[model samples]
Target: MYLFLNGEILHKEEAKISPFDHGFLYGMGLFETMRTYSGHPFLLNDHLERLQLGLDTFNIDLDLQKLDISGMIASLSEKNGLQDSYIRLNISAGEGEIGLRTTPYNHPNILLLQKELPPLMPLREKEAVLLKLRRNTPETSVRLKSHHYFNNIAAKREAGDDPGKEGLFLTKEGYIAEGVTSNIFWISDGKLYTPSLETGVLNGITREYIMELAGTLGIPSEAGMYMPESLLKSDEAFFTNSVQEIIPIHTFEGRTFPGKRGRIAQQLYSHYERDAQVLFSKNELHRS
Candidate 1:
């Protein structure tokens, strides 16, 4: 694998960051996981825009405009020999004094890594257990994909590595939140519903797209806090994330759903695949 560090391409062992970096020391950093379609990044601008917002919120002064992101990705893809790739883009507050005091003036360190995207397995219905660990209020008042991930880590630890199960989280107030790393959605009577962002959801890019897709297809959709009982009664349910898109849920603890890959889920995924090609054409993707 080849990783882009600042301005150079380096092997995994060659990449390095200061131990004192605020991101390393205090979890002051942002990361975006992206997927490349064919030979180019899918929804690159959307991801970057969200990243920019995080940079502004944290007062981290990293300007992405001065850097040629498309070129960097292409160079890395060529070097890594992985045209279809999974990307991890990181920006951390550079080395700073050790303390909790906010250090917004530190230079930002950038790291980009690329790897071959494996063939996606069939989208089977997943089983999820509602964990006792409740999600905390976002440290920044909104989720920003920051490095402060102990809550999620703890939940993941509790869930363990089960191929057939995932951890579902609840808000401190005991409302439906989301899956460990994916946004939760359910369909009832042909209507689509998801936990509102106000419920401490991550505002996933794929989740937003699916909402738009539902509107475009005339599927009734709503986003708001719902009780866990709502999901248990759902006719169909699924989770969404950038890489995997949509994964149907077969059973939530003991309550079982039809898990038949409902019409909404199927159409959204189909359109997502088609939109990727039309939205990211060869000319736009390989602009470098």
Candidate 2:
């Protein structure tokens, strides 16, 4: 695999970052995992916008105009022979002396890695277990994907090595926070239900799109803090992420969903796929 580091691409084995980087020393970094459709990145703008916001929050003034993100993604995909692919785009405060002083990063490290994926199929179904880990709201602001990942890592370690199962985290208040690495949703009598962002949950790009799709597809949706047990009120449940657009949840802590593919999920997924095709056609973005 080739990794786009800084402004150059290198084999993964040769990729390296300074050990003194603040992102490594103090967990001061940001990342976005995205996927491609016909060679164009899905929601690249949204991901970049979020990355910029995080960089801004820390007073980092790296001018993104100097970089061609779309070009890089497309070129990287072509170079790696990836029409259908998984991408991990990461940026961290570059080499900084030890300690957590509020100093600006003079040399931020930006990297992108691409891997081939089979043609995207419906994510099908998976099972989940409620974890004992309590997700507390950030003492600062709402969560964005960041380097402080120990809580999530710990939860996943406890979740064991079941590929078909995932762990769900509940807020310290006992409300459903999110999945280990994806945002979760459920359909209750055709109305979509998910946790509100006010809970300091990670602002997921796909999570936002699902709600937009619900409106486009005319499925009523609501986001707010509800008891974790409230998931039982739904007929079907699913998780959303960039790579796996949607995966049905057969059961949550033993509460089985209504069916393999619920009506609302089927509609939303169908519409999403159709819309993407139309988007590619209209934009004429497929790369060879």
Candidate 3:
């Protein structure tokens, strides 16, 4: 695998960051996980735009104009022989002083890594388990994809007992917010219902795409505050993320629901895969 560290390409073992960096000391950093198809990155512009937004919110400016990220990703993919890969982009405040103050640091640490793609859980059937965790609202940290993910980590650990696939999180007010790292959606009476952004969710890229695709496919969908009791009303449920794409939820707290592998989820997954193919075609055209 090849890693791009602060504009230089190097072996993974050769790349390193400082211990005193604010990103390390206080978890004051932002990151994004992306994937590539046929040696081309999917939704590069969207991811970059989100990264820029995070930088602005954190008041950390980087010379993204001179970075040539698309070119870098291409070259790294060719060098690493990566046809399909996972890309992790990270930026942190460079080595700061001992205290919680920003000192004279000219260089912020930038880490871009590309590695072999992991095996995705098969999508022939969708299944998930709901946990008892609630999500934080937008008033907390909705704008930034920061590194403070311990809450999600804790929730996952607590959910290990359930044998189902993904873990769903309800809002503090008992409305469905999202999964551990994905957006939540359910189908009821031919209509799709997902928690609105007002519920303090992450506004995931996949979630946005799903909404658009649902409209194109004539599947009525809406976003609002959804309660746990609403699951009983749903014909099917699934979670969406950049990597997982879309996965079906089978059980919530040991209670099985209808449409665990229902027709609606299957149709949505088919449309989503078609969209992915379109993305790959666009990337290939750009490369040509």
- Candidate 3 lDDT at 74 equals 84
Model 2 error, position 98 (Å): 1.7
Clashing pairs in 1: none
lDDT head-to-head 1 vs 3, winner: 1
TM-score of 3: 0.87
Q: What ranking of all candidate models by lDDT puts the best one first? A: 1, 2, 3
What is the TM-score of each predicted model, taking all chains together? 0.92, 0.92, 0.87
Q: Report the C-alpha displacement of residue 59, candidate 3, in angstroms.
A: 0.6
* Between candidates 2 and 3, the lDDT winner: 2
lDDT of 1 at 275: 62
Tens digit of lDDT per residue, candidate 1, span 113-188?
8878763434667787899999877876678988988888999999888867779999988889988888999999
Off by over 4 Å in 3: 63-66, 102-106, 118-126, 137-143, 161-164, 254-260, 280-288
Using lDDT, give the best candidate's number: 1
Q: RMSD of each candidate?
A: 3.4, 3.4, 3.6
Candidate 1, residue 205: CA error in Å? 0.9
